[model samples]
Target: MTQTTEFDWRPFLLRWSGEWSDWSDSRSDDETRSEGDEAARQGRWLGFPPASEERIVAMEKRLGRQMPPSYRQFLKVSDGWQHAGGFVWLLAGTTDARWHDNESGLADMFEEDLDEDAGPDERRDAEIWRRGLQLEVESDATYVLMDPEDVDDDGEWAVYTWAGWRAAPPERYANFAEFMRDMHREFHSLRAHRTEGEPEFANDTTRELDALVEKARLMALRGEWERAGRTLDEAKEYGRPRAVGLGDQIRRLLGQTYMVYFEDVVTDPRYAPELLPSLVAEHAAHSYRDDSTLMFHLRGAGDDVVSSAYATLERVRDGTYRYTAAGPFGEAVERARELARWGDTDGAWRTLMDALPLWQPLGPDHLAPMGWVADPLLGPLLTPDRGRELLSTPRGGQAGEAPARSAGLDADNLTWLADPDAHDNLTSYRFVLVEGVAPEDLPGRLADGDEAALDDPMTSDEARRRSLGGQREFSSYDDRALMSVGRAGDRWSFAFDGDPAHFDPRRFVSPAAAAAAAATAAGAGARAVVVWSGLRTWRGNPFFHLSVARDGAERYAFTYADAEIHRTGEIPRALDPDRFFGSGSGKVEGEGHAEAERSLLEAVTGEFGVHLPRHAITNGRLHTFTSRSWTRAPGNGETYAVISLNLVRE
Candidate 1:
């Protein structure tokens, strides 16, 4: 059905009532059960009998206005409804619906809220509340109102919901039909959380809608854009739950939206210059109405480089900026910017997408390419075929020069921690080593006997598969860490965890803290070392880190990336930088980065007397735990991103 069609509310109402009846039948309460039985015996459920046309017309005449077509038609099907939504006990029938008398001084409060700074929408919202018809017969300070003056061409009155407990302004709807349909979906969502077993709507239509959404998702992943768009459109008409999000994603890839933000997008070394101008312009345009000053608040959050970037973005947004990037991909981005300036969004998106796979980092600070598997818009565009080509193709070399192979680390040296596919473009791996801990006891120790460690242990492969499966719905960063644990050496235990396609350092606990926690979990005089090494997917930069902790305190941490070495805390002589690099200074003078990292790891293994069984890490199973115990809480300002590097170079 289309938006303009007279939506059939009867089926939704019937299904809702049926579900409620089933729930009622399952209830243990004697009074409620007897009431439900009496209603079933009387051939009636929760909904009221249909109102006669004459009765509806009389009520309309008394009110001196016509009720919205949707609401009037709804009364014809059922005079009133019970449990309209969230604590809404009863909806008004023709006999009960009336003009809301401002007895609670709600209109006065609305008027007080409309100060000199209020926008057109806010003013309209306040005016409607004073004049709208009240629909709720019983509620906990919640209201469903219809504004007679806010009529559409189709004679549909705008609906508004005002709840005293809600911190935000009243929510508005285009019409009653949309509101009811949303409530029905809300019913299903709520029921899905409270109960399980049968479908929310055990009908062919629900199954069809679900199947259509699933098909659209698969189509999008396969880069069947046009087909996926059309399928999602069809699913949206069916009111499928995931259709809206999928449709938004498709629209984003089609250049109908831009990914602009204060940090993630702007701080990204790639595409920031191309995207910041648009972000600034959009923020400026909406600042008056929404007060969402994303760019405005970024003043002085970083160094001169950040400030310079901001200034450049402001100039670009104001049409006074000048610069032309110098390479094939850069030139393509410049052309896209020009097309975007001329409002040729279609051309802009086409040019950008065509050059995306060829993207190389501008500098050492540009850690990864513009888009990879996790990007909501660009990711889907890089289908399996395109992805394979993108990964296999090497980037960054003199023009006409034969592409050289990437330097491979000697896997035999770090066999226990070596990635079998270390040369694979998308491969990433992480593991923690704790001294004085057993494989079976490590999970409990690491989690400090938290309930999160209560799950039956899983194998390393099984845990990795689950983390990468996309079926695990993590509500928080803490839920993101699911790791497998195993014995390393006689005195050491190792743990492994998987990383999602979207890697955010902010979502993780500090590497040092993670290492420290492992040591603490092993009790007195325990030592823990953690190592994380990986290449960002598809010919991206290599990142490697090593941290050591003893007796619950971090001792040393070293990071090798961004063309710089970051060291925290004093280096112990046993794992000395001079001995490992032979420079006597921690600088790579005459060796490749892969060799340097391998040498560093070799020193740590040789000194600490810690090593993992290669077979156990590569092919064997190990016990697992959900690693939420050490996850950093971003909301509490314990964000891993903001944590200082505490770099102490020696």
Candidate 2:
């Protein structure tokens, strides 16, 4: 006969499940007797064949060490539960090994003595005993059943406890190669339930590890790199033994966070300096690569970041940035540098002015260079004269003209009159004249006396009335002369018809001194002087020739009448000697002859008390002459006709 090979099912049975017990003494009479009888009738549970006395004795002899009472009792019982294609066994037993009693039999005591009530102290001791028993159970249960092919049937079984039931495939693998294979196969099916399944098994260390891995992935989605890295760290700490390839996961997340932090810093450009060091340190601690480029950009050792940013802009010219929006700081810095180089202090000032409206909300440190730029920019815009002008007048409004008096003549009113540029324009000057004594008293009364009369209460309204009264008589000073005088106490009042021309006393003391002499001659109180000057014609002279335009021998000629100043002397001399004279001849045709002549006479007489005689030697001729004493050079006493003629030909 051929040699027969017999397969012992014992190893498979032991590997399939933990021990089971019948609870022969402790079970209820109906359930225990029935279930035990049923299991015996069934004949095979976990492939043990039957719990016969002969089998027990054989196992004990083979193993050498006495099996714990719990194991014997468990073998005598019905199988417990089935899972993952195998049965799990529950054992019941007692031990007399005192030291081992706490280690192996504590669970037996709890199961057998259910009616025992212990005091707090006894309860505490029982808890301690239970803890020891738990440790033993865990140790006995610890085994990793490799693939079935790896089990050795002939190996010594003395040191091996029965392998527990295979409940399910382990949720995570300890070996990386196996894990990757499992992950690939389960990747899709496992992912659908991961969010719900992970937390359900969260109390298990292995499940918590899975949960953390998922959490890191979710954080990555939200761009929360820092938080993702921290979650990966926790997963590594808890899942080190069971989490396959977790180290790589953690490393990848840390690297991601490092890059993200650098990107954030570069984009914002405004984080506090104190934060940068901490950020860089975190990246370094994580062993992140690519820090060199970030460090160079932030620390400015290699190609200043601002300059580099500007260099990248294609449309920007001068100091202004265009196209992209990320470079205001770079633009501002470039603008400041350009302003400094070009010496455009005012342009710089304006730039800062424009920037203030834009940058007011920025923090002081960020705005520091701008503030520094403003000082140098503004320095050149201010000067003493400009400062005075700014202080004296409204920024962009009209300035106040000289103030006019209501009654008495105010010397202060003469202040603006001294300006030679003052004209008849309403914007130029304002004049107020006061009248008191009648015009008939001018021959004998001093200007000071007239001024005193003008100050009198009774004469104040009269002075105002008279000053305005002559306004309609003369369109301007050139038309007619206006005079007024008043007196009251020591106040003096004097008025003139037209705008007075003020002469510097230092330059022409004669007129001022003569006026003073006249005032002294009249009285010590006040004085007034009135004079009227008009136009005079000139003689037929070559200098006064009119221009003729040739039009085929039919000439069109026109002559302009001009005015001449005769004498600007004392009042008595101007009126008495008849020394004033002028020359003009022939009919004249000119646009502004009358007005120009009147204006010329008024200008000269107003400046130097002079009047020209009104008489013509011709129908009209444009000629100008002065009295013997009032020549081109008054001191030279040379008198002659002066004219400018133009002739036009087509």
| Model 1 spans > 4 angstroms off | 1-5, 26-45, 195-205, 222-650
Give the lDDT of residue 554 in candidate 2.
12
Q: Global lDDT of each model?
A: 0.57, 0.29
* Residue range with the least summed lDDT across 10 consecutive positions in model 1: 371-380
List where candidate 2 sits over 4 angstroms from the true fold. 1-388, 392-452, 456-463, 466-494, 499-582, 585-650
Expressed as tens digits, the lDDT of each residue in 1-650 for candidate 1 is 31323878677677777766665555555544445345742453567889999999999999999898999988998888877765576788999998886655677888887889989888877776668899988877888888898888888888888887887788888888877776665555454334455335444455766787776655444445567678867666555555654564445333344433423334544545544444444454455535335635454344543665557545533434544445677677677554333223334445655564455545422322332222111222333333333323334331222222332211323533433353333246666777776655555546544533533333355556654564433444444456666555556666666453333443444443444454434256677787766533232455556778876778887665544456779977766544544443345432344555566667777867665444333333345665543444567655333222343699
Cα RMSD for candidates in order: 24.8, 40.3
User: Which residue pairs clash in candidate 1?
Assistant: none
Of candidate 2, the 10-residue stretch with the lowest lDDT total is 613-622
Residue 644 in model 2: lDDT: 38
